[model samples]
Every structure is written in C-alpha cells, then in structure tokens.
Target: DCSLAAEQLKNSPRHKAYLEGVSLRQLQKLYSLLKGHLGGESLAESLENDKELAKRKSIMDELFEKNRKKKDDPDFIYDIEVEFPQDEQLESCGWDAESGEEI
Candidate 1:
C-alpha cells in the first residue's frame, strides 16, 4: 500500500510539488504507521493479497529497531491506524518520493 502510494505520488505533479513541504520526522512517523498497518504481517489478513503492496515493502527497516526501543509499551499491539493519520487521508495526500512515505 505504501509502495503504491509512493508510486502514485511519483506520478503526480501535485505530490511531487508538495514533497518539499514536509519534515523528516513527519515522514518517518507516517512510514512507521503505514508499515504497521498495511504491512505484510499486519492483522488485516487480506492485505497480503496485494501484490503491489507486498512487492514494495518498507524501506525504513532501520526505523524498526529504534521504534521498538521507543515503544511506550513493548507488549502493546500498537494499532497504528488509530494512532495517527487515517489511511484514506494519507493515501490522498501521498508521501515523500525519496522514502515513499510521509515526511
């Protein structure tokens, strides 16, 4: 899903133009949320059927370790969809092209 978002943004003149409008931290947070939501191992079993999303897995693997350490509760399921921007909104807005996520 995130990958498709990136690709979609890449094809969009408005998204490309808006890329310079956000910050790094914002991008990272968005990436983490998307990864935790539409990611392959997410609770949504049907998400796995998305070959486009699966092929374009997270590029922010490094954030995983840092994020795990920062997690307020390790045992928490940490539902991201509720924790941050709604999927529909993010999809409509698109993310940083370089990282293929919010920034």
Candidate 2:
C-alpha cells in the first residue's frame, strides 16, 4: 500500500522537490515516529499480510544485524599503507643492494 502510494506520488511533478529535499535520516525518523504512534501490534499483523514487504524487511534486518556484528568485531582492522616504494626507489633497512642480505 505504501509502495502503491509512492508510485502515485512519482507521477506528480510537484512532488519531486518535496521528496528530494527529505534526507534519509529524516525519512527514517518519520517512519519511526509514525510506527511508534500507530502501535506495534497492528503493524506486525498488517506487515504479515504483505509478503513482498515482509521479505524485503527480513533481508534488511539480516543485513543490519551483520553490519552491527562487523562493527562490534574486535579483530577487524582497517590499515592503509599508502606510500609503498618502488623497487628502484627502495631504501635498505638491513639488506645490501648487491647481496640483498643483512648488513
């Protein structure tokens, strides 16, 4: 029903600016506020009837869970070595140029 309404809105030329102006955070907040006021019991009941929406919601839930897990993981490391030297421009730390062994 929301998608049907969204499709109807897409046809309206005036709705473009109004829809485009709304940020993702604003839309999410609005959805949460509306859902809270509407109550959760009937929401679940109605969502159960919309199989397509329910499927999409389930996938989104799974993805969000995975994302949270990844964020909370202790072993995750994001390291970047940006300035790797080329072979010709490389400097010796302990190895000689000819022998390539520790000095």
Candidate 3:
C-alpha cells in the first residue's frame, strides 16, 4: 500500500521524497526485526507443545513476510516501490534516485 501511495506522490517532488523517506525507515526497521528473529530461537515457550511460541513467531513473520513475494520479484517483498525500465516513460524513469527499483 505504501508503495502505491508513493507512486501517487511521484508527481509531487516534496511529497514523493517525504513518503519515500518514511517508507525507507519502515523497511529498515522491518529488516532489523526480521533479522533478529531469524538469527535467534524463541526466548521462552511456556506451552508444552510450543504452540504459543509458534503462534508468536508466525505473527511476526506475517508482519513483514521476509520471504513473501509474487513471481519472485525482489520489489514485491516489501511495501516499497519498484521500477522496471521497459514499463517507464522517461529516460531512466524506472530508476528512482531515492530507492532502487530492483530492491
């Protein structure tokens, strides 16, 4: 959704930059949170079958979906915008200076 909002703001120099920055920070935070979780195991599991911990982990996974995507494009993995050269009009239009399309 954020990526779509950014697209709508692309025509406005100020708003586009602002939204891009905010979305970028969101991405960074999401990355750090996922990295932390992926690199470690559950801190505690009070449930004998670990059901609670499993549920907690699943919720976290859904929040960002580190491996979530459509057609394996790197951009769809997040709420950030993506650019494909052939789909753009301007010279290098797909390449937004603020964020890489291939990201």
lDDT of each residue in 43-76, candidate 3, tens digit only: 3322222575678889998876765677668565
Models sorted by lDDT, best on top: 2, 1, 3
lDDT over C-alpha atoms for residue 13 of model 1 = 81
Clashing pairs in 2: none
Q: What is candidate 1's CA lDDT for residue 9?
A: 55
lDDT scores of the candidates, listed in order = 0.55, 0.59, 0.55
By TM-score, the best candidate is 2
- How much is 57 displaced in model 1, in angstroms? 26
Evaluation by TM-score, superior candidate among 1 and 2:
2
Candidate 2: what lDDT?
A: 0.59
Question: Where is model 2 more than 4 Å wrong at Cα?
Answer: 1-14, 40-103
Pairs in clash, predicted candidate 3:
none
Best by lDDT: 2
Q: Give Cα distance to truth, residue 34, candidate 3, Å.
A: 0.4
**Over the stretch 5-97, how does candidate 2's per-residue lDDT look in tens digits?**
454454458776677766555555445445645775465554454566778999999999877635458976666368755667655774454
